[model samples]
Target: MKRVVAVFRQQKFEDVKRALLAIGCEGMTISEVKGRGRQLGVKESYRGSNYCIDLIPKTRLELIVNEDDLEDVIDTIIESARTGEIGDGKIFVSDVEEVIRIRTGERGSKAV
Candidate 1:
């Protein structure tokens, strides 16, 4: 099993969700997050004030699936999230030793 974590600009959430669902992904967890990457956020001015916003707003999605689905999932995220600009965010994949569904007490692949 594997856990896929994708962090992207908040505006891309809908498109990303649609892409994942179209590929038969059953469920995922979404979160509103603040982070900074290579672009390092941005600067904005109000009135005579100047400030640096180093923690940018972003969306985070987490899904656990069978290892075989990893590549397809990753590809789907990239295709949906790319914007030809910075702040597009990133994806991280890690092995999941086990999963247990709360309602049915299902474990392993069944849980996923």
Candidate 2:
């Protein structure tokens, strides 16, 4: 099993979600997050003043999938999230030792 964590521009959330669902990835956790990468947030103007928002708002999507589904899921996220611009965001994958469904007492891939 694997855990796929994707952080992307807030505006891209709907596209990503729809694409993932189309590809049969139905279970995921979504969060509203604030973070910055190499570009370090962005600059904006209000009235006559300019300011830097060091922490930019982003949407985070996390999913657990079987090993076989990893590549497809990653590809789907990338294709849907890419904007050819900075802050389009990033994806992180990690091994998942186990998954358990408390209500059904299911474990491993079955739990997923």
Candidate 3:
């Protein structure tokens, strides 16, 4: 098993979600996050004052998939999230030792 963590600009969440669903992804966890990427951030003006925003809004998606599905899931996220621009975000995959479904007391792959 593997855990895929994908972070992208917030506005791209819907696009990524749709792609995931199209690929038959069962479930995922979503989060609103803020961070700086290679783009660093941008500047804004208000009342004749200017300020730099270092941390920008982002969306994080976390899901666990069987080993066989790892590449497909990563590809889906990238294709959906990439905007051909900076601050597009990143994806990380980690080894998962186990998974358990508390309600049914099922463990391992079945739990997932």
Instruction: Please give the CA lDDT of all the candidate structures.
Output: 0.94, 0.95, 0.93
Taking the tens digit of each residue's C-alpha lDDT, what string does model 2 give over 1-112?
Answer: 9999999999999999999999999999999999999869688999999999999999999999999999999999999999999889999999999899999999999999
Candidate 2 vs 3: which has more lDDT: 2
* Pick by TM-score: 1 or 3, better one: 3
TM-score, predicted candidate 1 vs. hidden true structure:
0.95
In model 1, the Cα lDDT at residue 111 comes to: 86
lDDT of 1 by residue, 1-112 (tens): 9999999999999999999999999699999999999988799998989999999999999999898899999999999999989889999999999899899999999888
Residue 23, candidate 1: C-alpha displacement in angstroms? 0.6
Order of models, best TM-score first: 2, 3, 1
What tens-digit string does per-residue lDDT give for candidate 3 at 1-112? 9999999988999999999999999699999999997888899999999999999999999999999989999999999999999889999999999899999999988987
> The CA-based lDDT of model 1 is what?
0.94
Residue 29 in candidate 1, Cα distance off native in Å: 0.3
Badly placed stretches (over 4 Å) of model 3 are none
Q: Which residue pairs collide in model 3, if any?
A: none
* Pairwise lDDT winner, candidates 1 and 2: 2
User: For model 2, which pairs clash?
Assistant: none
- Better by lDDT, candidate 3 or 1: 1
Q: How many clashes does each candidate structure show, in the order listed?
A: 0, 0, 0
